[model samples]
Target: MRFNKSIISISYMLLFFQISISILGTNNYIVSIPYLKYYFDIIVLFATISCILSFFSQTIAVKELVFIVLWLVVSAITLVTTKDILVVTNALMIISARKFSIKKTVQTVFFANLFSLTTTLILFILGFVSDNNNGTVNKHSFGLSHPNQLGAVLMVLILCSAYLFIHASKNIKFILVILNIFYLLLLNSSGSRGAILASLLMFFVLILFYTKPNYLYSICLLIGVFFFCFSLYSTSTSVYASGSILNKLDTVLTNRVRMNNVFMTNYGIKIFGQQVLYTGGSSIMYHADYAYLDNGYLRNLINFGISYSLLFYIYLISVIRKVNSLNLYSAYIIIIPMLVYGFVEEGFTSFLTNIVLLFTSILFISNEKERE
Candidate 1:
């Protein structure tokens, strides 16, 4: 069988992001990707060049440039004061990597699910040996404790939704949809409320992206679910996501309180360069969730200051609108989940998380003009 160029292109794209992330993600505690903190600029610079080449060659969308500019501005502000610039680089790299089509989009989704499942299985075994003592559900895959990984799950789910809405499929598509849902459930049982919330938000996103009559669409979704569940087997991990859907929902909101306080504080809202002077939380840091922060908006203002924090939000919202205007509902699917979850979790403020979000946003923007 002949391989399609779009498949080849997307494979290359996912490879690029995956490699960069693996090389950088760590638990050293000083900051996940310190290299990203200082030198990720070089990668972004290269990504800028790549996006331009794709645009000129008509291989990607011109709206890609909008993201590049937004990233550059936020990155510059973040670096000038905080001297950290990973998000900028990741954002550009993300933009240049993904320009989704059916085949590659599906591949992207499969690979993401595969990776997530593999990781979950490994952890599950580890938990079994430790008699489930080493890690607990509430703290593991879902919260600020693992935002980066949780963010990845959300990205893949968004990509899957993008594929579903973009193209009409047959019985196989329905099966694939069911599988994705169960796979998502298995991943969630590993215990992450953020992931759960993110998935639900995307369900509605599909509705928003499609401009046609949505009532009739319900039949299509039911078909997809049937196909999805039909493939279940005995070895299939039967562990229901351990707790209530309302399970850790309160813990999520309580943490939001301190985050809110972060924003509510005057120091949190200062413009760029002001962070250099406000050394309050710099010396003191812990897990955003295990710690406590109620106000999401206020958290950024205090932690990174008003300018850097606000720029981050602006970058996110602007990219969403850009994708929506282009009518790439899948990209919208990706962002909506994160937006809803952002209210209860503080990962939105982490340099690592923000960078990941930035990069994913760019991919959707570039994919706006991607063909069927």
Candidate 2:
């Protein structure tokens, strides 16, 4: 069934709000009151439930439905045992894909990020945000808990800006152009090198292919992916090889390479996923029982284990096929930045990534079925 526009709009808006709050750190940015945070969480919960209900109104293959159920069951199991609620919430987003068309989903996400970024800038102007220059070139959190978090949020915004700019009406096109310039500045201020470069590259690729999609677009996407991966590998290798001169670079990652090595050595990979001690020194504490793996791919491996991660990858492959079948190459190109960013950061874990991807995935699935 076609869902009510009002409900879908509210749900998508809340989804982005939920993500903004998640990145903003419930304890610090907007409301420090415990009950207020709980109330917001409840609102987001209800919205997700509404979206899920809408999802089932449409026809779906029995096998596909079964796969979704199994995924939820696995997610619930992981949540109860590991207490990583992101697993369950992320599943909700995946289900959300069916509620709207690709263009609407893209527009919603764009507006959501716009709302988020606007609020953040206002907070920063009012001196409500943190401006801790924790030795980075620009450690402006802009209401987020960390510079990197702001960088990540802006990365998503930048991508959204690029997509919307391409598809926007003449009246809004000028605003988007100006917004793109500002987004780049924000990215720089966030002092996240990986996010900055990856975002720029994604934006550039999307712009290049904005006019039309072609068979060769797949090859172009593969090339983009290769360059991203190589850039990440080269950066990490060079930083480590530089020795003491780039000790700060190592620290910037929170010594993630070392931390990852230690954690793997101590706990090792589990077949079904298990909780371990947090390895970072972040002041904000939520689920203190499990150690934070900043890397999204590794986080999935350690949290969901090989079996579950394999299922997730399979779903991603299907989504890729759907988009490729439709020749929505720009949409396909967008996922590359996040995938590359996930290796060094928590893009896969972050709500910003999930919200954007969920909508895109739904768009692909819907388009694929139409083609058939």
Candidate that scores best on TM-score: 2
TM-score of each: 0.57, 0.80
Error of 2 at 34 (Å): 3.0
lDDT (Cα, tens digit) per residue for candidate 2, span 72-147? 7877777776676666766666666555566666666666667766776787778776565445665677666667
How well is each residue in 1-372 modelled by candidate 1, as lDDT tens digits? 123444436434644454344323321232243564533444455455644443433444466566556656766676677554544444444454444343444455445445543554454455521112114444344221243354445445444544554564677577657766665655455454555666665666566556542332343334323422321111122211234322233344433333333323324345653442222142244323244442234445544555655566665555555554554445444445555445544554442232324334343534533533
Residue 248's lDDT in candidate 2: 53
Runs in model 2 deviating more than 4 A are 1-7, 23-31, 36-40, 135-137, 207-254, 282-292, 360-372
CA deviation > 4 Å runs, candidate 1: 1-16, 19-70, 94-110, 119-155, 158-168, 207-252, 262-266, 273-289, 292-300, 304-315, 322-324, 346-372
Cα lDDT for residue 205, candidate 1: 56
The numbered model that scores best in lDDT is 2
Query: Clashing pairs in model 2?
Result: 1-57, 277-291, 278-291
Please state the error at residue 297 of candidate 1 in Å: 4.9
After superposition on all C-alphas, the RMSD of every candidate to the true structure, in Å, is: 11.3, 5.0
Q: After superposition, how far is residue 255 of candidate 1 from its true place, in Å?
A: 3.1
